[model samples]
Target: MKDQGRSPRKRTGGRRRPNHKKKKHELGREPTETQVGDQKLKVVDSRGNTQKVRAVTTDVASVADGAETVEATIENVVENPSNPNYARRNIITKGAIVETSEGEARVTSRPGQDGQVNAVLVE
Candidate 1:
C-alpha cells in the first residue's frame, strides 16, 4: 500500500486530544490552564450588591498554599453546587488567601468531573 501519511489525528481508532498549542485565552495566555483557568469581564451580584467581576478561578487538582491561594474581598459558598463534592450537600463557606485580579476570591474544593468545574463563584 502507498503511504497514507498522518491521519486527521494520530491514532486510527482512539480518542482525540485538543491542540493545546493553538489555544488563545482571553488573558493573552497560551494554555497555562493548569495553573489558572479562564478570564472574563462581567457584572455579578455580590452580597445583594452589584459589582464588576474582572477575573475567575479555574479548577485545580491541588493548591500551592491555602493561606496564599484564595484571596477574595467577599466569599460565597455555592449551595447545591454542581461539583460532586458539594453537589450532594451544602458546602461550608470560608475565605482563603489567594491573589486574583478581582482582589482575593476563595478557592474551594472543586468537584472535578467530566473534565469541567462543577461550581465556582466570581466576586
Candidate 2:
C-alpha cells in the first residue's frame, strides 16, 4: 500500500525517523485507468462506511451540448493533459478530449471515481 502521510523530514532539512508504522487510514490505492470497452464497474469500500463506484471500462458517455444532453458512444481518446501515453492507451479521465458519436468532447467528470463518463461538446 502507498503511504498518504506527511514526509519524514523536517523543514530545516533534517532527517526524521517514523515513530509508528503505516496506518490503515493513511493508506492509498492505485489509480483506476478507465478504458473504452463494454461497461464494467467495480464497487470499492471507502472511509466512513461509504462506497465508491469505479468504472473499469465503458463505451458510453453523457455528452452535454449546451441546452441538451445526449448519450453518445465513445470512439477513442484524442488527447489527455494528464499523460500523453494515456491518450495512446485509450484511457479516459477528466479534461481528456474524446471522440464521441455526436462529436469531439472534453470530459467533465471522473469516470474512475464516478463510474460514468460525463463530457461537454467541444467546437
Candidate 3:
C-alpha cells in the first residue's frame, strides 16, 4: 500500500488543520516489474519529462572485484529480506545475495530501478 499523510497524534495546543487533498505528485506507488530469467526491459514515464527503465527479466550480472569486473550469468537469488517471495521468485534487487557463474555475489545495484544488475563477488 502507498504511504498516506495523516495528522500527528501528539499535537500541542488547539490547532486546526486545513483540509488537504492528495496531489498527483504526492501519490506513492509500488514497482510492479519483477526481474528474472532472460533480459527484458520496459520504459516507464516518471514525474519529470523523462523515462525510467525497468527490467522485466534478467539473466546476467556484472560482477566486480577489487579491480576487475566481469559479466556473469545469474543463477538464482540467494536471499531477500525486503520480500521473502522475491527470493523464491528469483527477483533481483539491491543488497540481495545472488549466485553467479563466478561464485556467490551480493547485488550492488537495483535492477528494477537501474534496468541492469551489478554485483560484487563475495569471499
Candidate 4:
C-alpha cells in the first residue's frame, strides 16, 4: 500500500516525524480507466451514505468552447501526460488531450470521480 503522508524532512536538513499513522481517508484507490465502449458506471461507498463514481467505459464527452458546450463522440485519446499507457488505453482523465468528433480537446474534469468526461476545445 502507498503511504499518503507528509515527508519527514524540512528544507534546511531538519527531521520532522509523522504525528500519526496513515488514516483510512488517506488510503489511495485504484485509478479508473474511462475507455470507449458501452457505458458502465460503478458506485463506491464512501464514509457515509454518499457514493463515489467510477467510470468503466464511456463513449461521449462534453466539450466546451467559449460560450458553447456540446456533447461529442469521443474518438480517441491523443495524449496523456499523466501516463502514456492511458493514451494507448484511451483512459480519460484531467489534463488528457483527447480527440473528439468536433476536434481535439483538453479534458478538464476528473472522469473517475465525476463519472463523466468534460473537456475544453484546444482550437
Candidate 5:
C-alpha cells in the first residue's frame, strides 16, 4: 500500500551508511572543498546541466564583458568555528575570484552542517 511518489529520503532504510564514498570527476584531490571558503566552480547539476556558479567567497566576481565561459581565482578560505550550520558549530568562508554562467560568485561549505553550501557573491 505504498504511494507512488519518490520519498524525500532514500527509500532504503535498514542499512543507511554506504561502504565507500562516491567521488565525482570534478571534485579534484581534496577531502572536501568546504575548507576553501570562496571558490566559484563550474558545475553540472543533477540533470547534466552546466553552470558557472560562484563560490561562497568575497574575492570573486562574474565577468561582465559578455564572456561565454566563467572563471574564478582563489585567494584563501577560513572556517567559522561557531557556525550553527556546522556539525559541532556553524561555518563561514570566502573565496578569491570567480566567474560563472550566472556571471560569477564565491562559494563555501561546512561538513556535517546544513544540507548544502552557500553561494554568496555573484556578478
Candidate 6:
C-alpha cells in the first residue's frame, strides 16, 4: 500500500521521525489504468461511508458538441498529455484525446474515478 502521509524529511533537509503509525485515512491505492474495451466497473468503499466507482475498462463515451451531448463508441486513444506510454498502452485518463464515432474528442472527465468517459468534441 502507498502512504499518503507527509514526507519523512523536514524542510531543513533533516530526517524527521514518524510521530505516529500509518492510518487508514492516509492510505493510497494504485491507479486504475482504465482502458478501451468492454465496460467493467469496480465499486470501492471510501471514507465517510461513501463509495467510489472505478472504471476498469470501457468502450463508450459521452461527447459533448456545442450544446448537445451524444454517446459515441470509443475507438482508441489518440494522445495523452499525462504520459506518452499511456497513449501507447491505450490507457484512458482526463485530457486525453480519443477517437470516437463522433470524431476526435478531448476527455473532460476522470474515467478511472468517474466510471465513465465524458469528452468535448474537438474541431
The number of clashing residue pairs in model 2 is: 0
Between 1 and 4, whose TM-score is larger? 4
All candidates: CA RMSD (Å): 16.0, 2.6, 3.6, 2.9, 11.6, 2.7
Candidate 4 lDDT tens digits, 1-123: 455666789988899988878788877788787787767899988766799888888878999999999999888899999999989988888999999998999999888897898999997
At residue 47, give the lDDT of candidate 2: 82
Model 6's alpha-carbon lDDT is 0.93
The CA root-mean-square deviation of candidate 2, after full C-alpha superposition on the true structure, stands at 2.6
lDDT of 1 by residue, 1-123 (tens): 223223546555775565434322212322111123332223333333544342333423223232343333222233332343442232322222333334333445422211212223334
Clashes of each: 8, 0, 0, 0, 28, 0
Candidate 1: residue 42 lDDT (0-100): 33
- Candidate 5: tens digits of C-alpha lDDT, residues 1-123: 222323345666644444444445434332223433444343334324643343332333233344443344433333333443432221233332233344334444432122234344543
lDDT of model number 1 = 0.32
lDDT of each: 0.32, 0.94, 0.82, 0.87, 0.36, 0.93
Q: What tens-digit string does per-residue lDDT give for candidate 2 at 1-123?
A: 455566878999998887788787876789999999999999999888899999999999999999999999999999999999999999999999999999999999999998999999999
Comparing 3 with 4 on TM-score, the higher-scoring candidate is: 4
Q: What is the descending lDDT order?
A: 2, 6, 4, 3, 5, 1
Q: What is candidate 6's lDDT per residue for 52-72, written digit by digit as tens?
A: 999999999999999989999
The TM-score of predicted model 6 comes to: 0.86
Instruction: Give the deviation of candidate 5 from the true structure as CA RMSD.
Output: 11.6
- Report the candidate with higher lDDT, 2 versus 5: 2
